[model samples]
Structure formats: structure tokens, C-alpha cells
Target: MSPLSALKISLPLAALLLPLSSTLASPPLVDPPAVPIAYSLEEFRSAVRSGGPGKDGIPAIDNPRFQSAEQADGFLDDEDIVIGIYRHGEARAYPQRILVWHEIVNDEFAGEPVSITYCPLTGTALGFERGDTELGVSGKLVNSNLVMYDRATDSEWPQILGVAIDGPLSGKGLEEFRVFWTTWGQWKARHPDTEVLTDQTGYVRNYRRDPYGSYRPLRGYYHPDSRRLFPVMTDDERYPPKSMVLGVRTADGAIAIDKDALREEEVVDVSLNGSQYTVVHDPDLDTGWVFHNPDDIEIEASNLTFNAEGVSGSGLENLEAVNAFEAMWFAWAAFYPETAVYEGGEAL
Candidate 1:
């Protein structure tokens, strides 16, 4: 771990320092599996608290522009964190530095409208199908996660829950797609033709600095043992508050796998709601891929390839891919208090 520096700022103050702006757009909705939540819609809404800047306080990228990977090399360092997605022959990278300023990016993936959201406080980045709507930061937070609102109905959708807790669309869930939390070099190496989001985001702050903390060497609020900026609905001490976990949720349940454990074991088999699943570690990308293995297929990992009966693929191919994303342990626990957690290839 790297030593703390003057760059660190009090999180409460950090929230107040965020740039504020509001957009008239709203996020779209779809009928995907509702995220399993132990709390009622009322409880989620009741827990919501002002996260410093008010609605649109943290502006979202509406008209996103991109540059080729080679052009991005001028600003991006190899270890810089980026949220990546590949779909319909289009691969794009959204740098964390830019997202740290704008929590949401209303973007289109191969003609399919989607919203890429990141919660700096919770250390989560997720992509959701928006259809014709655009999501904006509600400037409200529950469990220290970003709460989003759609312009269409003015409903509140917490980024992690992916469900509206208030407004006419309350209880509605949004369709989601997979977004990889990996480094700049890792994403570019895998998708050479990837387009990188440019810092040309209309609103500008110091894009080089992260107000929350640093992910490169892990310090400030991002430190595994750092204290949370706000109180969560539920708290679990089983893992460090900021520790990263690859989490998956269904309409019935939720589960999380410790990233460190997945890295060590390479492959970890687990069960969710009576269905078998497997999490495979991709060393090259330094991320995990979760697959719904209903038949309990026996999987073997040799180097970067995973082999199973009637399945053979390098990294994340030839499997029923599940939409999962990396989240901070505290945030995951807060929303899904009953989530089963696994570490070291064993349930903990």
C-alpha cells in the first residue's frame, strides 16, 4: 500500500466540492430481473440522504465523444482505472478520472442506448440499458451508493439496486449489461480498436485528480480499511469496507465473491438460489467473469483458458454469461444484507 499524501481530503467535504449541474433527461426502464433487496421500497427511500451536491450537482456526460486508443495514450497511463464494455463490434473505455467528476454518462452502445454509472463513494461502476431515457444523478444516496433519477418519470433509482424506490416508476427494474473494471492497458490490450472517452466532457474540473481517493496504489477513501463517508443501512465487518467483490444478483437472491480469493483460486464454484455458478479469474484483465452453470459443470482452469464439458473458451467465452460487476463490500452488504459471501473458494 502507498503512504497517504496531501491529496487526501475529508469525504464529507469532498461531496461538497463536487461540481453541480442538472439535466432535464431521465433514465429509461426495462423488465430485467429485479435486484434482490432485503429492504422494502419505503425503507430504501427513507434511508436516502443528501450526498452534498443536490440533483444534477454531479453532472452526467450527455454528449460523449471518443478517441482511438492510440490518441488516448497521450493522457491515460497503463495503470489508470477505466470502465470498459464491448458490444455489437464496438468496444469503449470510460476513464475513472473523467467519471469521478461526472457520475453518469448517457451513451449509446451500437445504437442501443445505455447509461454508464459510477459511484466513487462505493467503488462501483455499472452499465444499464436506457432505451430513450437518460439517467442523471439525483444527488441523493442510500448506503453510500449513487441514487439516479430518470427524466421521463422523475423516479429515484439507486445505482446499485437498479430499481426505483420512489416516483411513479417505483419498483421498476432496469436492464443491465456487463462492464469490466480493469486498467487502461488491460482493456486496450484486449480490445485494440477500443474507443476511449475523451476529457472533452462539456464540464471541466481537474480531470487528473480524484476527489475521493486513489485506486492506483489504494489510499484515502479507497483504502481497504478506510472509513465510510456516510452510514449504510447495514454494516458487515467480515471484510474491509472498501475491499472489492464481484457481485451477482437475481430476482430471488444475491451473492458476492471476494476478488482476492478469486485471484488466488482462479476458479470458484458457488450456488445461488439453487442454481450452480462459476467465477473464473482472468489474469490478463485482472477481473472475474461469472457464469450461470446450472448443470454444475466441472470446470478446470489451466493458465488463461477454462475447459468444461461441452465448453471450451479463453477467458469469458462459450458460457452463459451473467451480468455482474465489482462493488465495494460495504455497499453490497448494505443493499443485500442476506447476500451469501464466498472467500478462498469457500462460503464464509
Candidate 2:
């Protein structure tokens, strides 16, 4: 059995060997983002609770391996969900099946270090620039979201907030990038050269099995109406707890666009702190793109393409896009209780 597998079968012995905290010091590797935090640093630290796995229990894939799209087809079904990333001219797909077992992947894009993070409980996948340090699962949870720690300083960061609540880097946020939550088939069709993460993730696991639930049929924990597995800072009853939403956070505040409504309307515009933002649906990827439209550009969507001020293109190619990710409604509301909700092509 592998080392991690050995630990799994011997949890009592493993728990005795692992340390609860780290005392090493290192420079911050991430730059803070301009986003709103609903709670004070202390409040966030106090809200953290053990997620049962313990530190590094659900190991992060530090040195990930990958296979080509054609090779990936041997194991993955067309409907299997994937977190797609296309950056610095490189396209890669991190399969949800693989990530469901390991929550973070320390990766490199065009030589720049980064981390692909996912919180299965909150249904969120986000990318962050990691610089020289690697992020690992802290085996903790806040608002039912994953909490990560940097190996360098052991700072605790709730995945949704992306800011450190404790340790040397407390109150600092990580620079984020957009991660497209798409299907294996959709991603392969769009980027044929993409590399899919392989199951050779150092730690042995049944990559085919998802502990929480399945996303294909949205049953069990992923069902739209299912209750959260853990307690949160706060709750909202306006929408079902597990409903999917495209969440965007900015310096002004946070906003959540209903994914189903965005699909129907194609284009929805909203104002955050007097700044206009346009959200357009990309049918090919089945995702939403949020654009900071301060100048109020008129963007029209047709089929699989978008036209913004006479510049037409596929996806958000012609327009600048902001960092946005798919998250559960309850998780978003818990982190940003005052966040504005947009549904039915209008602000609710």
C-alpha cells in the first residue's frame, strides 16, 4: 500500500505522528486581491472547525501528472465534470473525479507556480498564483468550505474567502484566476490539446468514487435542494442551499448570478457600487463570464458567440473577463451575507 493509504488504514497512529501547527517562516508568495470580507479576521479564525480529515489527511497533489485528452478518454466519461484552465497558452483539465479525492493541485503554467483548489462541500473550484510555496489541505472547514495552509507559514485560508484568517499571513488574500467548471467532453471539444490530470497522484485512491455525491445527476449532497453537510456562519432561504451560482467578489462587495437564469437570458447586467458589470452565458462551456463594464458596453449574446460594441467573438475572447467561479448559493451567502443576488436577468 502507498504511504497515504497506509495512513488511511492506521488513522490513530498517523494522528499521533502529525503535528498540529508549523513554526517555519517564509515570505508571502501570494498578492492580496481587491475583495470584500464580511467578517473581521478574528471572527473568521474563531469560526473554523475541524473537518475530520485532520491536517494533510486529504493530501494535496504537489507534483501532479497528466495525460493527453485522447488518453484520458479511456477512463473518463463524456459527462464527467472537469475544472478547465487555459493560461499562458497552455490548456489543462483537472478532472473532478481526481480533485474530489485531493482538493488541491500544485501546478505550473508557463513556468509560473500556481494552485488549483477545490472545495467539494461548497462546489467551488478556483485557481491562485502560488509563487514559490505550495498550499495544502489544513483539514479544517469554515462555512462548510475547505481551509488551506501554506507549507511555508501554515496560514489558514478558507477556500471561498481566499484570505488568511490566522498565522503569519493573516488578513492577506491570494491573487485568483478564472477556472472554468466544464465537462470533460466540452473541454476536449473546445481545447483539443488539453492535458487531463491522471490518477498517478502519488496518493492511492479510487478516483472513480466521489465521497460527497455525483455531479452528473446532481443527487445526494449535490442535489439542488439538499442541506449543507456542515454548519455555516449564516444561512439564506431565498434559494435552495445547493443551488449553483456564478459568484463574483470585488472591492465594492460581492454578487451572485443565478446560473439557470443566466442560461435563459444569455446576458445580464447589474450595478455594484455604481459600477456596471455584464454577465454573459457561454453555451459551449456551460459557464458564465463576468466583465467589468465601467464604460457600459452593450454586449449581446447569440448562440455560442457574443457581440460587444460591434466586436464579435466566441466566449469572452474580445472582452476582458474578471475572476469568477461556480459556487453553491448557501456557501456564497455564508461568506458574503450582504451579497447582492441577481436572477431572472435582474437584481433581486
The candidate that achieves the highest TM-score relative to the unseen native structure:
2
250-295, model 2: which lDDT tens digit per residue?
A: 8868999988788898888888888888887877788887888877
| Clash statistics: count for each candidate | 6, 0
**Given candidate 1, what's the lDDT at residue 230?**
93
Candidate 1 lDDT, 1-348, residue by residue in tens: 011321486787656644332333445555553568688888887899999987787888999999999999999999999999887778899999999999899999778889999999998999988866688898999999999987666788899999889998888888888888999998888888899999998775899999888988999999999999998999998888999999988764789888888889988988877877888888877778778887776677774452211124653355687778899999999989999998875665
TM-score to true structure, per model: 0.88, 0.89
List the global CA lDDT of all models.
0.83, 0.84
Model 2 per-residue lDDT at 264: 90
Which pairs in model 2 have colliding backbones? none
Model 1 residue 31 CA deviation (Å) reads 4.1
Which pairs clash inside model 1? 20-57, 21-56, 26-134, 26-150, 26-151, 27-150
